[model samples]
Target: MRFIRTRTAKATAATLVTVPLALGGLAAQSHAQDASPSPSGTFGPGCSALAQKANTAKDKVVEAAAAYPQLSHLVSATVRAKLSGALDGKPNVTIFAPNDQAFQQASASQLASLLSNQGQLKKVLTYHIVAKQITPDALAKGSFTTVEGGKLTTSGSGTEFKVNGKAKIVCGNIKAANATIYVIDAVLRPPS
Candidate 1:
């Protein structure tokens, strides 16, 4: 009986020690997960230029884009498309904004024709936006529907990403009051 008691006590003692150690490992893992950094702030190569040119984190999407001189043409196009209110009013969104250089990439007549038609202009502009704010991590291998209801796919990892397998994200993960802006090197067109 004493031997049985001793064996039972040893088992109980081993369980006590083992249980706490197992729990401690789980606690450490939980803490590590809790401590892992969430995606935040801005990223990409053009961020340096953006830092030198503007700080629009506190402004609304339209106004934030306006703050960057590189985005002047995009801002103008957004206003002309009558999308300023829509973009500014969104609680959360992702804007794949094309810089002025991207606008210049289009033929003069093509740009003029699109601008002259409000419906087409709005469709083109909205094609650059996603309803949900997307992070750089998600931007890698992302397939999202745009506000224009056309699908856009993103590829590449780290700071380099492309839209529709073409437009390179120049400056990405930029924060605004209502949106996150990723400045792209080319305008994205919606599917007809």
Candidate 2:
């Protein structure tokens, strides 16, 4: 009788230990499943197709920078570094990407001065971004507030949008899951 009782106690203790481990494993598995990427490779819901499109915009940015060595250096050193954190989540964002010519037109000394002041540089770049995706068609004769607490004006008859009343949208409608990127001919500036 003692032998049987000992074996029963051992079995109960084993179950007590194993059950929690099993439950823990299951809980971890559930978390992994919840965090798994969707079949389309996006992290979460809404605008998966748009997110796929944004990858193309990223590529285009790289390509444009490559084609323009000086501008590419600034993009890699300044713009890309700043945008890393802002692009990570599921909120809609619009990026106004300036081309090489725009950077070239800027006074090199002024550009250098801006780069020396990181806060000002970050604000300038973020000012070109909107917190929501905006289609080219939607950007007619209106202003959109930026992430940097400034407003960017848009004006055009059709398919020709401009930012800050000047920077023309050379390429538009590059979508991401929670964002859109518009390649522009000029960099935008905040009101002094």
Candidate 3:
């Protein structure tokens, strides 16, 4: 069974095509319409780091993520899930990528278990990715759907949006060639 949020038209063109194996992974906002929503409030520690490349960027989603040392584990997880094409090739994706330290805090056994199963890994990773672009303004209210077919509820305003009522959007509104990225401090787990 699949779970989806009560929302409208978050997915448009992409269906996560896979010729070999289906993989998953995790964007920021940069556009006249993709506003930051918060100018004075501070978010997570990585905000400054993300801001440095938040705008005036030309790299693709995955490529841009790979540039951030903090997102190394997320990039690796995406590669492991064989989701490079979905993220790198597709457009208008929004990713709530968890930093490396988030994974580092997971139980060694849990990490090992996910790494061992591609299907399970895909579901977990996709839970963090939305099929459509999500701006900080849009995130100010309502729920959203993940490619994994799960519900991600957002509350709070500006740079304080939280995912699943737990994971905080530390760095957000980052624009990439094919996606928007929100760096979160926690990795969102899909319902069993």
Which residue pairs clash within candidate 1? none
Encode model 1's per-residue lDDT on 27-109: one tens digit a residue.
99998645422378566667777643557788999998888888998999899989999899998899999998899999999
How far residue 140's Cα lies from its native spot in candidate 3, in Å, is 1.8
TM-score of 2: 0.60
Candidate 3 structure quality by residue, lDDT tens digits, 25-112: 2112234224446532335446776634344248888888887788898999999999988888777888989988889989999999
Q: What is the lDDT of residue 157 in candidate 1?
A: 74
Predictions in order: lDDT: 0.88, 0.63, 0.77
> Which 10 residues in a row give candidate 3 its minimum summed lDDT?
19-28
Cα shift from native, residue 154, model 2 (Å)? 0.3
The regions of model 2 sitting more than 4 angstroms off are: 1-74, 77-81
| Candidate 1 Cα misplacement greater than 4 A, ranges | 1-38, 51-54
The lDDT of model 1 is 0.88
Residue 33 of model 1 has an lDDT of: 49
Q: CA lDDT of 101 in candidate 2?
A: 66
Q: Model 3 segments beyond 4 Å from truth? A: 1-45, 49-56
